[model samples]
Target: MKFNKLPLEEPVLKGVQDLGFLYPTPIQEQAIPSVLNHRDLLGLAETGTGKTAAFLIPILQFITNSPNNKVSGLVLVPTRELAQQVYQDAQALNKYCGLKIVSIYGGVGKFPQTKQLKSGVDLIIGCPGRILDHMRDKTLQIKDLKYLVLDEADTMCDMGFLPDVNKIISETPTSKQTLLFSATMPEPIRKLTKNILKDPVTIQLGNLTSAATVAHTAFPVPSGLKKDLLLHLLDKTPTGKVVIFTRTKYKAKQLARDLSKEDYKVTSLQGNLSQSQRTNAMNGFRKGKYDLLVATDIAAHGIDVSEVTHVINFDFPGTTDDYTHRVGRTGRAKQSGQAFSLITPEDKQLFNQTKKKLDIEIPLESFKDFDYGIFNPSTFNDPIKRNSQTQSGETKPKKPPHFYRKSAGNKYRKDVNGYRRSRSSSSGEKMKTHTSSNNYKRRVRPKSKSKV
Candidate 1:
């Protein structure tokens, strides 16, 4: 149905038309009605499916149509980036409505936020931590709160902000209408809905998996050669805006630097970066100033860059849910995109699990020029296959291996008697092997006359 057909105020409808949104997305079409009817709602939809607009439109409508406009609406998000994004969406949708909206998030100075809060905003979009800080400082009050939205509920749980979320919810009025949205409904989010929502209308659009428009491909390479494979793939693959996901902030920064050195327009979005740096990186990437954005899982959710052409997982995510969010960065808004992952032998278990859980076949691809034999799964210490000691019923920790100094040629020669000798130590100084139950270290004798 068209957005104008929905029960929305004239100002809200005008704002919708100003944004050129003619028809409602499936989630918006289904969930907006329940939300407008002043009932609690639980919406399950994947990224890039217009979930933000679904809640924002109705929230804005209620605020515009309300007789008393206190600080009635509050939206709790998981990340600073998401807070800003939703704030912008709210601004755009509240154009004709002229409702006062303020975005409160950490990573920036609080003076501006305090000023805005004191000035009396109609709605607030903020992260849980910053919102709690404001609540503690008594700068923002929500006792009379009417509409409360918990966007990306699963992400907040994953990021360990559930306690803060619950605290914030407890401070709000119990009679308020609550709306909870998530891509996947894990046990924590399920319990959350039961407690926060009151007979909510549940609207689930798709399966709890990655987007169907994304074509998944895995390139098996050695751990040490992941960077090489990434460079090669970037050179060969045609992409507009590419997002590369790494597991650590350090990896994101280092990879972004490496890509910059290779003359690729790149930036990094991770937790370690300063607030301004993070904002600049995200804004630059979104505006096409940078072709590649290397980020941690912080950017996995609530980032609404609809034109992303590709997503590369430099480090395979730790869980299937993380994998879904990483790949979901691309294939947004029904646009087809490619998701490439550099899979090491160590990721074999997670790789298998992801395919099985997502119920999709991710084709193993090999580059014609890159070598894939550098990492041998058989030789690699597979955690799945423990040592023989475990089979022998030995529970004690294994002894540390002895380390000897390298020879002049950096090679050790094995004699016929099973003894190892350095080529430079021809003076009959044979390398001795020692086994000890406790942690042990053997010092090599220096060439000097004094013993070390």
Candidate 2:
């Protein structure tokens, strides 16, 4: 369906025409009408599927029709980059209509955003934390809010911002039209919708399991050799506008730095960077200043870079949903792309689960010149266990260690080297340390529940 065929105002249609968008995307084709009808909407769409425009267009139309000077519309996003992108899209669509819109996010100073709020914005696009701050300061009031949108709700849940989101939602009037959009809906998001939306129209554009446009491949490699294999793949594969995902912020930064030294136009986009730095990295990546963006899952939601040729998983994703979001970064706008992951024995379970759940074939590829005989597990912080061959030729990892170790009344003692050692019982009991690699777990504490 075309934009003109939908019941859009003349100014909104003119803006759409100016952008040269002849036909509405699949999500847009269905969601715009439901949004226009003023019904609560729950839309499931993949990344880069024009879902942003789908809701933005109808919201702009509603605001244009009413022309309320108060903050009538509010869009809550998960990241600063997404807030900026949505603000830009709102500006482009509201050009002829001339609606006062402002984007508020953390990372930068609040003085500018305060001035904009003081000037009286018709629509507000912001993250939950900063918006809650504004509400507390009495600078921004949304009691008269007519439209409320929760974009990238799953990302907010992942970032531990759902509590703040709930607080913000409690402030808004229940009479307002609510719209929730996500690429994939997890249980938390579903629970959120149950509380926020009332009998909403559900529009799902595609399968929620995986991106059909992406070709999946897994390279069996030791965790120690992942970086080398990534480098090898980068040298061998043909790519344009690639995004490499790491599991942790430190890894993303270090990998980006290491790749930069090798003359690769690469930049990191993890949470460690300031707002300006994040914006610069994204802008540079979009403008072709950088060919590669090494990021955590923060970039997985609402980053609208076009023509992303490949998504390389330097580390295995934590869950199947994570795999979906990471791979969804590529193959956008109906373009076919490739996703490659370097897997170790530790990642085998999750990889197999993802493959089975997505019901997709991921061929195991071996580089012709790379030697697979050099199996090194000591390079990792904890050694990766390998399957032992038995008499019947069945392979199984050795029995796992006991969970709790027997400790004496003096629990821990510091050795001369300053390392803490667990004391054994006075009965001369041997303390068996659980050296199983899977026993080691890393917990990343959220800096702030309110921060994006």
Question: Which pairs clash in model 2?
Answer: none
**Which portions of model 1 miss their true places by more than 4 Å?**
373-452
TM-score: model 1 vs. ground truth: 0.83
Per residue, candidate 2 scores C-alpha lDDT tens digits across 49-154 of 8888988999999999888689999999998889999999999999899999999999899999999999889999999999999999999999999999999888
The TM-score of candidate 2 is 0.83
- Full-model lDDT for every candidate: 0.80, 0.80
Error of 2 at 184 (Å): 2.0
Per-candidate TM vs. native? Answer: 0.83, 0.83
- lDDT string, candidate 1, 1-452, tens digits: 78878888798899889988898888888988889888899998878888899999988888887736579899999998989899999999888888899998898999999998887789999999999998999998899999999998988999999999999988888899999989888899999999999999999876878888888887766655677778877766657788999999887988888887777889999998888888888899889898889999976465679888889999999988888888888888788887888877668789889998889887666655555333332222223333356666888544323333322221343211111121122322222221111211221222435678
Least accurate stretch of 10 residues (summed lDDT) in model 1? 414-423
The residue pairs found clashing in candidate 1 are none
